[model samples]
Target: MNILLDAAQTAARLPWAPLVDEIEALLTDPTVQVPPRTVLPMAAGAFLFAMPGCDARTAMTKLITFTPANVGTATPTIQGDVAVFDVASGARTLILDGPTVTGRRTAAVSALGARWLAPNLAGPMLIVGAGVQGQAHVEVFAAALGVKQFRIASRRRASAEALAAHARRLGLRAEVVDDADAALADCPLVATCTPASAVVLRGQPRDDAFIAAVGAFTPQMVELAPELCRAIAAQGRIVVDSRDAGHEAGDLLQAGLDVDAMPALADIVAGQPKARDARGPVLFKSCGWAGWDLAAARLAAKSRPTG
Candidate 1:
């Protein structure tokens, strides 16, 4: 029998700390298989994405869609579902809500990476973009890193205000700022979670800052400027969640980086010798991967108190 989890149920089950640990474990696990994502363009400017992965005990695939036209409607800009299967029997086992799974898992991975790479995180965290991803990052980082202040910036002030309000409810100090650069100044941590085609954050962050660029999935989309990438790359570091990052992450591609040249997040997590050092401004670019969805879904199955 297949189990189905809605948005609320999934949220209740998969909290930040455990979810972040699960993602951390999955990235370092040698038995896991995470293939590059396949992007298929649909009619009417929509995009269909397929990400698949497997572990020793289970496998899963997530199907999601991005429709630009759906922005103002009741439907979300991102819509999709994930299918989980038993690795041994090859039978379908669960179906998880894609949006919730994607949002939380993505944020969890960002938080996990920050936890390890930027161990001394402090001061205000600048969150660029005030959508679902923006909110998720705020919640996860506040809980995991104990960040006391958040400066939420978006092209839309109303959106930023709403996210700041949500952040306040979480017991963190948050404020809406019209200028993204102003928010970046003196901020120790920054998460760019927008889907903008052009760069959203300008100028250089503090030398000790840690950046998580979670938006700009396509080759034409970018959230960080090429100069920022160059600066971070000069340290011989610009971490990414997957090997396919160069191909899928526009922020790196635009900076003239070959996807294959970048180091995988797993290697850094495993404590490889040449991995990124603790000093300098560290940038973690996430282009999305299937293994993350698989890990989150498996955790959801185990975390459901009533199930």
Candidate 2:
């Protein structure tokens, strides 16, 4: 039976709360397998996924969260779909509208990093780029981390104000900001969600910070600036989903970094690469993975009512 996890049914619920424990459990266990993802991007849309094998069959989950931020602003932050198929039999068991999945799951991934990496990271947070990822970042942090203060910074000051107002309606202490460059310095954990051809967060903080630069996979697109990349590189470690994806990613590619030199996030999560040095900074660049979605799908699938 193909099950559809409707967005309306799941709204205003804590989707990622239980998964924090599941994610933690999955993190500690090494036996669980998620195969390398295949990504397809075009002017029309993009899809990313990985297959996590279980015995005779593997669960291949995909998330095609499109670039409809403009359209979704009137509707959802994302308008896409999610699916689960059998790796061996090639049989799909479920499909779901992905606005719910995309909103919560990516945030959970970032939250996992935030919980583990960001230390003494009290928030009254500041988010750069008032878009899908930016707003979602705030929700996951606030819901999971109990963030109290949230400052929204965007190119159009009006948009930032609108986002802040929408956020306040949800009861968050929020506001709009004119300068993203200024916001980065004070916030301990900065999540850069902007999608730009060149870096927007060039002057972002250098002070032993925890940064989740989650966008910019295309060779032409970038989120953080060269200076920010250099700053993080100089500070110490860079953790990625796959060295391959990070290498191909434009932001780091433009930074003149040897992508082959960086380690996979698996290693860091597994403790092969410690989260930080004695006292400096760390950069967690997520070329957001299929494995992450696979993890989230596994969590979401488990939440279904057994009838």
User: Could you tell me the TM-score of candidate 1?
Assistant: 0.93
TM-score of each: 0.93, 0.82
Task: For candidate 1, list the clashing residue pairs, or say none.
Answer: 246-259
Deviation of model 2 at 290, angstroms: 1.1
Considering every candidate listed, which one attains the maximal TM-score? 1
- Candidate 2 lDDT over 154-239, as tens digits, reads 77687688878878887898977677778776677777777654466777464656777776766666888887788778875566
**Runs in model 1 lying further than 4 Å from the true structure:** 272-277
Kindly list the per-residue Cα lDDT of model 1 for residues 1-307, writing each as its tens digit. Answer: 4378778776877888889889888876788887788899989777999989888888899999988778647989888898888889998878888999999999998988787776347868899999899999999998876888999899888999999999888889999888887766668789999876678986777777788999877787799998888878886367888877767889888889766877677878777553335667888899788888988977876775444
lDDT of 1: 0.83
User: How far does residue 150 in candidate 2 sit from its true spot (Å)?
Assistant: 1.4
